[model samples]
Target: MRAETGTRARRPAGPGLISKVGIILVGIVFFFPFIWMFASSLKPSLEVFSSGGSLLGSRLEWSNYSSVWTAVPFARILVNSFLVAAAGALLAVTVSLLSAYAFSRLQFRYRDRLFLVFLGTLVLPQEVLVIPLYIMASRAQMVDTYAALILPFAFGAFGAFMLRQFLLTLPRDYEEAARIDGAGQLRILVHVIAPLLRAPLAVVGAFLFIEYWNSFLWPLIVINDQDMATLPLGLQMFSGERGTDWGPLMAAATLAVVPSLLIVVAMQKQLANGVNLGGFGGR
Candidate 1:
């Protein structure tokens, strides 16, 4: 009995050596591309690939970063991306909150079927909808405008579906109690439900912001003027008949990653909780 107890006590408390090594390997695998981008940003255009995957170049080429600003209307591009992403995220979150409340809390006829139909829209790819969206935007005279960038995709069903799933998992007692106190639907959603949904809302908002920030194809199809181009479109300026300015392109990319990276890092905890409780795990 003593020997058995001692053996059990001697077992490792945390992940074993192999698990730790595997985790480290996986982290490195994911982080290596970012490292390569930053490293290549500091390299000469010619030396970017000629170094045979080595991170360091002959000398640190800080001018690549400077060249990025001069090579394109980068400032305007960054501003446009930030505005479009921020607005799109806010609009998406608001719409999701209202729609989720309606589907989950306030029921009418065939609500479940209606919700399932709305949810089914998620299966449709953006590429499939782009053509019709472009036609509508053209008809509305919104082409090359910020509205064209933001409005077309802001009403996606993903956010509404995710929020509704979370609402379904939530107890209705609080809402009922609020209703008894004569709280209106909008007031209940804003004051009661919205507060409780901070984590999931943060997750949805961050996802939307990242989606808008990194959007390339839709923006490319809609935006015609160089002044209105977003960061992803602006990056293309580095490539032309002269071939690609790899160093400057990487520099711009590294800069472009900062905002999304900061958002993800800031909301990391919320993101984790949202995934765990937001019905994303088959809950």
Candidate 2:
């Protein structure tokens, strides 16, 4: 009895010294760039490179951030990026929910085949679609518009595939009960299915928002007005004929990362659950 009690009461083993060291090294490797960017943001433009790989400069330059605001119409560009990202995320989620519902629940001929064909689109890179999308947007006269920024890439297969996988894991018992109660497809989707989809929805929304937030090439091709320019395009304002403004550019980049960072942090649990539930882990 004493031996069993002692064994049960013994403290659990913690990570080894080597494991702790490895974790610290891995953390430093992952976090070094952010630390470097923030440190460089406070340095003088010239000192940004001449600081001999040191994190700090000769002195702190708070003006770098103020320069970011005055050097370009940053506030407007920030608003525009936020608007586009939010709109794109909403649209993507709505479309994904509908598509996933149809694919996972509905009985139709060639449905799996059609889904496979749709999933094949995931292999197509954004670069290949840009030309055709640009032409379509041009014909629709959506150039230099928020619609152009948010619409072209909104209907991607990624969200649909993710949501569909999640939906497949869900039992049809609730859906069947809702149907027996005379609830329609859309009603069951909205009232019955959607309430259960919070985690996956949050994951999809966060990813789509980040994708739209960081987009540069498509917006560069489509938007002309500085007023309509997103953060990625706006960041280029730091580079002029005089050469690149490193300090202010770093400041702006840091500022740009905040929104997406907050979203990921806020949705951390949902994102983790969604990933695990989406066919990767057993329920």
Candidate 3:
């Protein structure tokens, strides 16, 4: 009887062990690049090249971070990134919310068709729009300006669509009740609907912020002045005149990733809840 009990206890352990192994393998796969980047950033330039063959290496040289910082206007680039991302996110969320509310709740002719056209823009990649956008920016003499970066991303179809879907899921009774209380549409939007939309708004804002923050191609194309360049563009400078400086480059790259990582970590709960709400509500 004791032997049978021991056998039963050990039976479940096999699957548990396998599951743990699978999880560890998956973790290693995902964590390997970050580990490599961090490790490379801590190595001296020569050590970085020498240790290239192994995933784990001997010594750590921490001066790469200071070298990278002094080599570029990293602080200014960081500020520019934050400003562009924050402005774009704020404008995108505000415009999208208002537009979505109108499209979802207001009665109008061709509303659905208009929204469908807006939704169609989602399938169009930003690469397709870059040339024309660049020409327009040049014509307006806005190249290398914050307006060039912030204004273009201020309105996004995805934000509008996501917000519209979320607004649709909300009970109309609240709006109706507010209306009966002599609250104007703007008042109701501000005092009622906006508060309820905190989760979805955070999700949309977070997404847009990350997009603008990490945007490389557009900034690389339009920003000619070093002072106007954002973090991604500035970080590209580390690739160098002769060959890539992997240690300082990785250090700069790691620093560039910090803000977005903090943003995600800080808003993770709101982001998750918003996504879930938007998903279930859409269906």
Backbone clashes in candidate 3 total 0
Native RMSD of candidate 1 (Å): 1.5
Total backbone collisions for each predicted model: 0, 0, 0
**How does model 2 score by TM-score?**
0.93
1-283 per-residue lDDT for model 2 (tens digits) = 9999887666343346668889999999998999999999999999999989899999999999999999999999999999999999999999999999999899999999999999899999889999999999999999999999998888889999888888888899998999999999999999999999998899889999999999999999999999999999999999999999999999999999999889989889998987877553322
- Give the alpha-carbon lDDT of every model: 0.92, 0.92, 0.88
Per TM-score, the best of the predicted structures is 1
Tens digits of per-residue lDDT for model 3, 76-175: 8998999999998999999999999989989999999998998888898889989999999999999999999988868778888888888888888988
Model 3 regions lying over 4 Å from their true place: 1-27, 56-58, 278-283
Q: Is candidate 1 or candidate 3 better by TM-score?
A: 1
Ranking by TM-score: 1, 2, 3
Which window of 10 residues has the lowest lDDT sum in candidate 3? 274-283
**Cα RMSD to the true fold for all candidates:** 1.5, 2.2, 3.2
